[model samples]
Target: MAAISEALTLSAGALEVVLAPAIGGSVGAMRWHGIDLMRRLSDDDRDAGNVLGVAMFPMVPYANRIAGNEFDFEGRRWQVLPNNPPERFNVHGSGWKQSWTVARSNAGAATLALEVTGGAEPYSYRAEQAFAVSEKGLSVTMTLTNTGPVAMPFGFGLHPWFDRDRDVTLQFSARRFHLEEPEGVSGDPITLPPELDFAKGGSLPGGWRNNDYGGWTGEAIIRYPSRGAGLRIVADPVFKHLMLYADPTKPCFCLEPQTNASGAFNRGRWNDPDEGVIVLAPGASAAGAVSFAPFALTFPAA
Candidate 1:
């Protein structure tokens, strides 16, 4: 059927992004100058329904892992079965593993939606991802609505893996960093150290880093000198955390703009203001956007 097999494409100027609503509502590909900016998704991978092969995926209802896949909220216990097996926790919520419906699509834009009813859980919600392309690059807007009868904690984020170039550099500002626990869940908050700071904009850390940066200024810069272009990433204020995952030995890196620090559902309920967690009442909704705008870079031959 068309709904199960077709991939939607959106383009503006030289920027293009593809969406596959059938599998996790992810961006299948993103390209500039016919060169991949975001990692490309292959047809084989798509047919196999592999989320890892996609350029990017949306994290919704919640983001990141929940320790032990169980947490207590408002005197009731919520348990989530591990969706990504061999993994002890419930990672990246339920949206990415479920198919989404395309609400609308055009040459330069598309909107996809996923609905989840808590049923036995406590997070009935509706999540939407809207993509728009322009000469400025790509704009992704994520929205979540609490569709259940009770209020619940929720978060929204875009998980984009960018291709790495030898000269690629990153820059962003955050007030603090959340340490990671042995299980990859957020542990405690600490001030940003110079070695981990990108305030001045620099290459990805030479070592592995998988932590959440709090108090993000909602902006980031990524440059690829070999390509003679760079991107200016801007986000809505609601996105208060910038999560960077870099492994020097890897061929890609990720800089995620999200609404709340990971594990906020359990340990951070009391730390609302600073952690950026959103507790929405029934029928209430929240939305934010992230943009990637490209600019040219020039270098003279020696």
Candidate 2:
């Protein structure tokens, strides 16, 4: 497969951006935050392999390791291929890390597509990814269509690693929380741990975080205290859930806005039963949208 790349410029008032599209359909670079917003690979950067930003598709459970990495769907046990080597489970989705085909390109936005054939599983999916630079912020959309001959279980999300530093404040709203057990414990839902709540807005005290939350009204605010630049992430009411990860030692934190709870397919713990688990029939298609808006915060510099 040949890799294709393109560049585009979008400006809306003070929000001007230069976007680079990689053949892999990933946003290679986003200029904002007074610098390139996305992390680029460099020889001296030890964490260069990290995914700066990618459109998550088909599914978005943190991983499949919990619950034995096995789930019974339609009376058959479907085992997902483990993507996390040490943890022994599948993660994000098959296509986030997989290279995507660039279908169209221009100076303002690019379209990328990918297909996944279920080989021992019970589902197949085709996804179209589009990234556009706008004065509002960076907008990414992923649409998944099921082409297989049966109802398939699926979810979608975005994994954007934001720069983690002492001067950043991450804030979001949630009325309830779901906690993932530490290693060696069973995957079960626990009450809102005191430290994980973000409804009041505060700083994360640097540590490992692999938890999911429900009851999100589909909105969040991330502020870079030093730059006075803040970002607002909003999802349609249909995608009413979100996930937060603040690993101080990892150099970044993830505020993943998702459609359903983690491991929803296997666990059947859809936050909203009616809007949960996208079951697309053969020849059926499903779509959802999420937006990221950048804004200038008026807080005094610390």
Give the best candidate by TM-score: 1
Residues 144-221, candidate 1, lDDT per residue (tens digit)?
999999877788898888887878999899999999888788877899988888999898778888899999999998
Off by over 4 Å in 1: 1-4, 300-302
* Model 2 / residue 138 / CA error / Å: 1.6
Clashes of each: 0, 1
For candidate 1, what's the RMSD?
Answer: 1.7
Candidate 2: where are CA atoms >4 Å away? 5-24, 36-66, 183-195, 269-275, 299-302
What C-alpha lDDT, on a 0 to 100 scale, does residue 42 get in candidate 1? 85
TM-score of each: 0.95, 0.82
Per-residue CA lDDT of model 2 for 8-75, tens digit only, reads 44554444443333323444444455543434334232124333343222243222233465666666
Model 1 weakest 10-residue run by lDDT: 263-272
Cα error of candidate 1 at position 280, Å: 0.8
lDDT of 2: 0.60
